[model samples]
Target: MTTSTHEKRPNILLITVDQMRYDCLSLLGHPVIETPNLDELARTGVRFDHAYSATPTCVPARAAIFTGQKQTSHGRVGYQDRVPWNYDKTLPGELAKSGYHTQCVGKMHVYPARSLLGFHNVILHDGYLHHNRNKHSVPMQEHFNEVDDYLPWLRAQVPGADLLDLGLDCNASTVARPWALPEHLHPTNWTVSQSIDFLRRRDPSKPFFLWMSFVRPHSPLDPPQAYFDLYKDADFPDPVIGDWAMKEDPQGSGLNPVTSKGLVPKRRLRNAMAAYYALITHIDHQIGRFLQVLEEYGERNNTIIMFTSDHGELMGDHHLFRKTLPYEGSTHIPFIVNDPGDCLGLDKGNVVSEIIELRDIMPSLLEAASTEIPDTVEGNSIWDLARTNGKALERPWREYLHGEHAQGMDSTQWITDGWEKYIWYSQTGEEQFFNLAEDPGELHNLMDSPQAQERIHYWRSVLIQELEGREEGYVQDGRLVVGRKPVNILAHLRSNE
Candidate 1:
């Protein structure tokens, strides 16, 4: 171990990938999709098999990651349309105050891409995609433009490339063409390049906290020609419920509701899956490059590297395309933490099966970095589990993991207690309960089962208690709002003007 003049504090490198499922990595033993770098990281670090996103969307899940609180507590529930700007303290802000140099690259999904929140330096690469907007000045929009720009180049590289027409909106007539290019030209590669540059130039005296968030394997399923070609002959597996062909969950379906469509055709599904997997592999390559730089800078051993996703992609799983559902395919994500033993004494290469939420990341980082965790933060640190090689010091440390999704009238609440998961929908008084241990695929609904009646009742009671505790009162016209804070002065001014 390298000795330091002062007590050595671990540097923090938190990597959040967009729309990544838990089983993508080779380490997770997936038959398809090669993620060698992530697999290696898992071997050197601790992987949490049961880790899940508190809010299975972009903004709220990100907010939960930055602040050790649930989405309801922080109030950032959905995309750009209805995200709450005013929220509680953030982890980066806390770390900055504690003498850590903070930086963020790639996507944060905050309203304004450059909203620092707490980082000293930020390179905003992607943000929310505004459906109604025309201008493409924002990072996310610009990134989409970049994809458009690269299409011509991709088409020229391939002999009969007609895949460029398969753009954003779902079109049954469209088909993807094979790509032939290097992974380094991908947007994720560029994001990793920016992060590596920042890491190389960052001052070593103060511990650094960098957020490398990559927007890949998300949508538009666009990978370079070479990556697409790599999976040309591979047999793409059908969705778990392919035989059923039943679209039970309306919101989770791959088809766009406004357009009134169904699942993409079999050929299109194969091409999309291939492109998606290629994007993931490309992302893994970028991650490997970033990790190499960290090692070269002698920061690997003294750094706490966390690899996770804001949420997961359905990726045609259960015939679902995007997130914002209460399913294993939508909510479950890979959470790997490489806490080098020199500083944190964390057991290397252990896979923890504890049911932890993304909100716990902030507190866990604080604990690992020897910094103070805020009292207002709702998540508890899993430092003990890490240090003790996945062994729980206390039984039943957490009874259940909670999640909320409130976008317009499409609101949902779910609680998972390892063995079972319960979901309650607000729009329609629909409830779904599943015994995950027995039925991993969640094909059977246990809410009406006589044997599961008591279990469902107990979980429903817990959900009610949690939601009641988080109820926010609103005012009509000029009446006083009981639980709502007054709108910020700047926001009020902007609105009035």
Candidate 2:
């Protein structure tokens, strides 16, 4: 470990994007989407190959990120809005306590619309939240037009223009279209622009923690014209449809625009894919712009940069379109930490295959900043693991991670250790197992295979042990109990002040 000296603390730059998959970058062997900027950033630091979001949705996953706690500790297991965000310890809060100037540029996804949680200032824009848009529960001043800082900025840029002018549904619907407004007017661009403004106005004396978040590549499938044209007619691969998915959705008939498990036709799916990729590329270029500004400030080498996503988008994998599932396409995400200052002695260009989750981000950042990690933060700092590539660790790392989320198909409980995965449905008691090392696409289910029975039983026991003392009584007499009602927010979180 580096000796603690009276050295200047490293500035932290957290760049987060919504609904970006782990395998979408060309550096990760993606055949179509090109993320040259992200690829270069990976080459400069450690890229986690098995990173995940346990509760693979916006709110719950972000809760893990901010609180540095697992789903059980944070109490958000699914996507639910309008719930109070009263966590005592937060990532930015800890950093700010260390004399860091903390500011968040994009999505916080917290309740009360303007809740800052910990950051000193939040130039907020939580893209298209149904709760804030509601006319009844939310007061008029708390509505999107009043609370969202980006709306007024956009209106000023183009008089009387609105984000919904294209008639695209923000969360659901797979419709694709080129952005009607100028490229710089898009939400993705606005996030970066606001971040640049923060850097310019920030107190240079204190180390700043800036969270530059982008809401795109999530939905609305609206890419700027130039980006859209780059992939509109390009060759794209077909979505990975598993045998199990075909059995449940045969003939491509489950065709609701917002259906979680439905078949999107070839042409329509391709259009959506192109638009998604375009948004990714757009964000990548904007990231490049921010890096250039950082260099111009002469702090590129003195800053610690981390790029990741809240969760992965299924992109039609296994007939799944969105997140909150226990599948790789939904839970897996890209995580890269580039400490140009080498503050943590991380092995640059190393691709760590060890299992990790969003909860780990908080402790890791606090550790790098030489700040004390609160007792409430349950996640272990990944500094040592990333430094030694798992050969040595200050503490023994977990063998597997437990993940779950409430869903329309009851709820999904899963366990994984990078190589294999086991999934159990809370209501149906149905089980599925996959050797992720062999079948990365999860094309086959091996739960019933004679040879895999022993392993499946072991994994099932792990789940049972995890849920033993839950308020829902998910386990009875050491056995998993099915038909239990799934809840969005766990009882512990609901009880929090």
Candidate 3:
């Protein structure tokens, strides 16, 4: 492929889904979920097989996306609400500064509920955030009715309609149901519908940066009746349970509806899988709708579309349900970039195996727009890797990535170099090592294997060095410390602005 030149900067469309697993796409050989639209999009550009969210939670992962910084730079290592998003630079904000009309159509998941974080305007719906929904916060703009643009829009479509009308808990892993409302009223459809409206009304004089973020395949497990029917009878594969997991929670899914780790009953798990797969297919079709609009509007070829997720839902992998785990089911996410106009001449249909993280999105997109990347941004642009099919790079690439979450189950610190991964529990000092090249499902623990001891020590030292000099005292005298209390936001980020 050769670079193609254009008189004007290409429009950027970033499509983000919540808690979508890397293995869920049929393009990547997923047996159940069908994502024809996403697969088609991938064929137009490049797909990354090893993309990850360092923190693997909504708040922290999104912080990395917006700020283009790692957990250390952004000061958010875990899921927390109400922390002000005061980053000096953001992806959408930077694009707006560079003369693009930027708008976000769905979930921001930021503090203050209404913080724009650099987009010129945002049509927000941050799912069911408990922090903003609490009674004390209701009087403020944090309330859903005040800050969620979707709520008002939904109400206008159908009087007295509420997202919670079905009474499903937002985080319930075992829950599954068909949406009670009309299919068009679903949040997935609304995101694309509103995005098309934005494209229609956008200022034609300048290029646009539209973020069509979807808040589905996350929870409530409620797909429209039609989508649910598509998968209700399909047989689904059982969750991969590591031998280590059974030792920890022998009771399994029997523990609770939302238990993070357990052997959930087959019936409930199957129902949840059906609903989850249905939600994904629905989103895929909605994306198809938006792409069609972009094409009909004569902007499809000139628009660059990138799709990814903040993190992956475990969905019973290793008996885990939600995110915040260092396992592949939680951290690994889908990342596909489609520059339909060949703006950067990216290798279409290329699947890059190099490890990339959420923070890389900012720098990559900014580079795509020919905008200056902020000096504070820690992630490197993935353009060269994508263009060269991960074989060559104009600049040096990271040999390994260090990731962490302040808390999940005793907090986690992990490192990976695409082919292998190492995880350490900060509080308990327990460790897990997986050769991803051999065991992508992570069904085996190599920590106790004598042959893996030396390699494990090398990875452990790397993590120790990465955590060295942190305020939390994660490392001392070149060794990882145990029992160090973790903070959701680091001291530097807490004091920053």
Candidate 4:
């Protein structure tokens, strides 16, 4: 197979789905949800079953994905925390410098709502909706204040849309539902339209790097009516680790404090799961539409498409509502890569079970574009996995993938090597271990089991070493400081209203 010079330089299409889980797709043998588009992408590309986020929160995972650095290295450790944008180099910025036309559409979640970082063109979609919830203010309040001129239009669309009646909140259960408005008006659809518009009108002279970020299945779980209907009668399976909390891992457990709330009724859990599935299916349809447009413009074959999420959502797993848990429910995310040449060494329908992280994406993209990856990046390039004649890569590439959640004093570190997994909780000084090969559901904690003591000690020592080797970038008064600005809690409160 002779490759042309133009073929060697592939256009990059990176699709990021917010709050999607590792097993949410139909291609992954998910029993209930129908994600034909994503499944199709997997069939034609490569599906990574063991891919994980460096940190399971939004901002930090995205920073890691873009910068090819760990959360500590990038200093964006928590949600809504101010990211150190000026300090690090980003993938789009590096690609743009290499002459690729970099474009971003939809949510990047950079602070101040408009940090371009590196993209040459950006279209903001779904501005800080749920993230607006602060102690004193919320995002809706900010929207109302800044978007008063657009309020009249918003009110006209839904006669009482602006009305804040706390009573209305109680009428609905936690089940996923269709948006009260038309699909075109929904934020996810709106973002997809903007991305389509950009792709349609984009200049073709330069190889392009486009980031299509979809915000859905995130929170306030809402999809359009048609999508909701798709799963109305579907019999959804229960979560593997249902309402069962494990012993806290001493290194740090990612389990949020809120998950301990009692199990939601079975029916309610089913409804919520169904709604979540519906939203995923809806996003899959939109992705299909986007791919159709790519084919329409003769760019499908030339574009190296990458689909992934910043982090996985709990979605009722372990009775958790949102992300931040170190469990597979929060850390593992769906990752698919389709190189331009269709030359990825793995079989067309192959599923790579080796563990990989979100940080690896930047270097992989650079390699696909035939651009040089910067030496500063901590991620390894997966170019060998995508090459036509490349060999299979080895596992435990970095010994263990580490995760950090430092919002509060409670911290967590997760170390996994596919079969046996260990989690350490710094705040409580507890350790949790699971024999994933025996109990993939993580129902049993073997941290104190005499039989697994040696494995536990090995992982604990590994975690300590990894932490010790980390560079203390910023320090103030004997504390390691990244110089992050305090988040405006009032701004979030105002947005909620």
Taken over the whole model, the C-alpha lDDT of each candidate is: 0.70, 0.88, 0.87, 0.69
Kindly list the per-residue Cα lDDT of model 2 for residues 1-497, writing each as its tens digit: 12123246888999999999889999977778989999999998989999999999999988999999999989998888878899999999999988888999989888876888889999998888877777898678778998899989999988898767988878653668999998898999999999988889988778889999889889989999999999999998887877887545565544665656677776877888899999999999999999999999887888899999999988888777878888888899999999887877889999888899999999988987889999999887887777888887766788999999988565899999989999999989888999999999999999779999999999999999999998888899999998888888888778864
TM-score of 4: 0.83
For all predictions, the C-alpha RMSD in Å is: 6.3, 2.4, 2.6, 6.7
**Stretches of candidate 4 above 4 Å error?**
1-8, 126-175, 242-261, 343-346, 387-396, 407-410, 469-497
- Looking at model 2, residue 382 earns an lDDT score of 80
Lowest-sum lDDT 10-residue window in model 1: 485-494
**What is candidate 4's lDDT per residue for 1-497, written digit by digit as tens?**
12344445778899998878888887667778888988888888888778888678777787788789876666655565433355347899899988788888877776644668888978765433433334255455444324222224445666665422222121122544557766776667766777788887776667789999876677556667887787878877776663237333443322222232235666666666777778788888888888898898888888888999888877656655567668887888898887546644446666766677988999988887777888878897765654421244554355567776654433566688767788866555566899888987788888668999999888877676666634322223433233333221223222443
TM-scores, in order shown? 0.82, 0.97, 0.96, 0.83
Model 2 poorest ten-residue lDDT run = 1-10
Which digits, one per residue and each the tens of the lDDT, describe model 3 over residues 203-319? 887888999988899998999999999899987888887777764555444558767777777788899999999999999999999899899989998888899999999998876
Clashes of each: 5, 0, 5, 29
**In model 3, how large is the Cα lDDT of residue 67?**
88
TM-score attained by model 3? 0.96
